[model samples]
Target: MTEDVPGVMMGFMENWQGLSGTWRVTLVVFVLVLMTAVTAFIVSRLVLWLERRFANTNNLWDDAFLHAVRKPAMGMVWLLGVYWAADAAYRYSEAEIFQANEHLLRLGFIWLLVWTLIGMIKQGEQLLSTPGKVQRPMDYTTVSAVSKLLRAVVIITAVLIFMQSLGYSISGVLAFGGVGGIAIGFAAKDLLANFFGGFIIHLDRPFKVGDWIRSPDRNIEGTVEHIGWRLTTIRTFDKRPLYVPNAAFTTIAVENPSRMSNRRISETIGIRYSDARQMAAVVAEIRTMLESHEAIDTSQTLIVNFLAFNASSLDIMIYAFTKTTEWVKFHEIKQDVLLRISQIVDSHGAEFAFPTSTLHVPDGIELSGLDQQGQTS
Candidate 1:
């Protein structure tokens, strides 16, 4: 069409005036409808081909762009087709209703563009944080924050441009916003606080989604399921959902057990007083075992020593940390260590102590109340 613009325009004008009023409207609508359908078909096929092409590549932007463009492009095609059809009808019939407003036409395009950008951001976010989708997946919380920020920027810019197109002064609107923001802030202070609290969480990142978090200030112990702008959803040990306001995180001291490098195995075992001579060997052998054990981390303060002496037993402390932080795996490791320690004690002819008592009697004060089998004599 650009190759012969003058020829095409002259030919179009010459033939356009030659058509009858009814035929002109019908021809315009038919031609535009056909053009819209063709354009929409082309866009879909192009998008499909692009998707297949981008699927083989690791670049996420092309895939996201292809996914985000399809529906909006189709809608835009139909929008322009219908608008031009109406304009043609109004020109021939002098009808007031078929008059398409150019302002609304421009605004529609702006809105569609905004929708496209927002859709692209959403797609990009999913691709970024999804495990196995990318080589180095981002943290879900950080991806969500960045996506929301980008979307907000796109929407705000679109709104400002729309207002500017409609002849509203940007400075005047900003001034009004500044004045009204104070009133809104006072009225919705709690909401604002929560918003800012969420922002801080995004910035500081003390705990993120999937972390096992507990608060010392409140009875809140759970795995984080979601981190939203207002509330953070936690799934407790008992499989209950806990909704905590973002503002609460600001005041509470949270312990994220998920981030712990190792799980501790601290236990005290006692041997009978009869095994007093075996205590030193037991302590030495246990320390040696822990140091050589595959699961125990010897670098992190491993201590095995005689702790205290109970009434009937000699206490020994076993302080160590396991290599794994997983709860189930840690327990399994601890069990294996305990079993090994028990076997070590048994190998030395020592036994674990339980509560027992022995009574003493003076030699002459004891009278015979019964025979050897406790029969009265």
Candidate 2:
């Protein structure tokens, strides 16, 4: 066994020295690949460790960063490993493909960086928008707006750098863009209008994601789901998705019922004319009930008064606001209030009115001579 070891070492060295340059290059490439595999494994393990470590912290930045870096870092490592391997091979042949290795590497680097940033932006947006995920979560609309804007900027910058890396002069491109922009603007005026309209919406913030909005000018009534640069997506009450161009919002009047501090309950109730004496008492009691009701907003206007006299009944109007603005809850409160009003009217011995007619017969006219027959039989 000891003699076999010496022979094996001598033969291995002889074979190694006898190999041609191409074979040596091939071996080098294989070694490089093996090293790349090992390095990738290490990176993956490290990322997992850091992810676990950072997961315990309340800060969102580290988590986002780690998530964004994983795939891009892996891609970059593989890219560099292959580039180096190819460069080593090209050193012998001076291949055309390998000549542009630096440019390719630079472009790949830019792409990976953009990818990382976009991933980070998405993660951060999610982290910030979710309720209770952070100490002070932001509204989803605002977070989405900021994230989309950042992603756009990152993509644009990456494209510019990519162009420059390809030897395209930035100044010349800018000059041409300036001239082409006017023509593009004229051609796509409506699209541009929508884009700017969305921008205005972001700035003014009349409504946001999850807001219940309606437009009197157009048939647009829904809850906003997503506010994009071109279109804002809304989920209708019937569960249909409605996509509206942002430009439409600029020309229309929108009502955001979600933002209302309180829901108003305005109704006119009618009762028989016989109940006229109880009107004042009913009104006073209803007003007093509203003033003390737990669900009513007494800070707002509350009026229970006789509005007008109808043809068939005496009309009373109830004008009050509820403390809650939730649609279902408001209706429940309204139901309770209406039921209480009915109880109040009943307590005062008043009944609701309906259409009725009256007949009159005077003295004793002996059928007025026309009831039996027209021929006077």
Candidate 3:
């Protein structure tokens, strides 16, 4: 291949002897540029056609992969053209110019390849993160973190390759990097802690992007927006954006409401003391209502009892869980249940209690005058 490259160039240049060295090089570059442009255009069309075909198919992996590679493939075409032009130009140029152009072209090609790999990794992460697509679906945060880590690895490897290509000793660079890394570790301890916290979060599967979580130790309660290496973003219920250190999740108990299979409904209703005699019937009817309600989860615990006698009323406890964890749906179910309970109580001629107190006056002793004075006072 090495011998054939020079032969091929010579054959192409045979008719261009009248051209000066600069013109010859310029003509060669322009031809290569034109070829690269045409090739890229054709390949892009071909890729679009493939994409259309992939879109029609049930397999999404291919579609994702095609999307990932399209831009990089076009970039590679231009890089190849530059590489060919540089190789041919090297023969006509001085040693210093040749070396510089050669190194520049090589580095460009290497980085282009790195970019391509990173794009593919990102696309794969997105594909894996889509819910119900994979056997074991990964959440968006985990996929994003993995993609970033992979891209970092690619960049580091590319840097090392670039250094080696530039004639740097790999062993020497590694030795220096070890010393620098120690210093960096000490300087960025908090960053590392947050990064490790994020790693643990992904591994433990405690919560994920879009999950509604509240921290017991902190005021952070909201839907997860994004989990980064050093911080996690949350969009609070009030629509405020909260930035929290990832390490906070490791130290605090995070309540993931999104993971719950059911939303709990624990309520206490008070009836007037005069209706105490009908408490048993009311409790039984409430229990029956819960059991028969389609929205309530009968598989879980359901309890209704005349639980306590308060100072002025009889307190009835109703504890149940709705089948749906969705906030809107759960609230609707709860409203329906409460309304039904109210209707049942009314049917039994029981009145819901309000805060009230009755004062007793002892018989005799001119209490009317004293009470009148007290009332006026």
Candidate lDDT scores, in order, read 0.87, 0.87, 0.85
Candidate 2: which stretches are off by over 4 Å? 1-15, 361-377
Ten residues in sequence with the least summed lDDT for candidate 1: 1-10
Please provide, for model 2 over 307-376, each residue's C-alpha lDDT reduced to its tens digit, 9 standing for 90 to 100.
8989998999999999999999999999999999999999999998888887676887465556466455
Global lDDT of model 3? 0.85
Better of 1 and 3 by TM-score: 1
Clashes of 1: 0
> How close is every model to the real structure, measured as TM-score?
0.88, 0.90, 0.87
Per-residue lDDT for 1-377 in model 1, tens only? 22232233334645777776577567656776788789889988888998998889868778888899888988888777666666555556777665444676778899999989999999999999998788889999999999988998999999999999898999998999999999999999999888888999999999999999998889999999998888889999999999988999899899999999999999999999999999999999999999999999988999999999898889999999999999999999999999999999999999999999997877777457877786888
lDDT string, candidate 3, 1-377, tens digits: 43345347646876787987778777776787788899999989999999998898888888888888888888888777766776777776745665676677779889878977887897799779877667777767778877988998999999999999999999999999999999999999999999899888878878888899998788989999888878889999999999998888888888998999889999999999999888999999999999999998999999998888898789999999999999998899999999999999999999999999897867775554445547733
What is model 1's C-alpha RMSD? 3.6
- Report each candidate's C-alpha RMSD, comma-separated, in the order given: 3.6, 6.1, 3.3
Best by lDDT, which number? 2
- lDDT value for candidate 2? 0.87
Number of backbone-clashing residue pairs for each candidate, in the order shown: 0, 0, 0
Candidate 1: regions farther than 4 A off: 1-27, 93-100, 362-370, 374-377
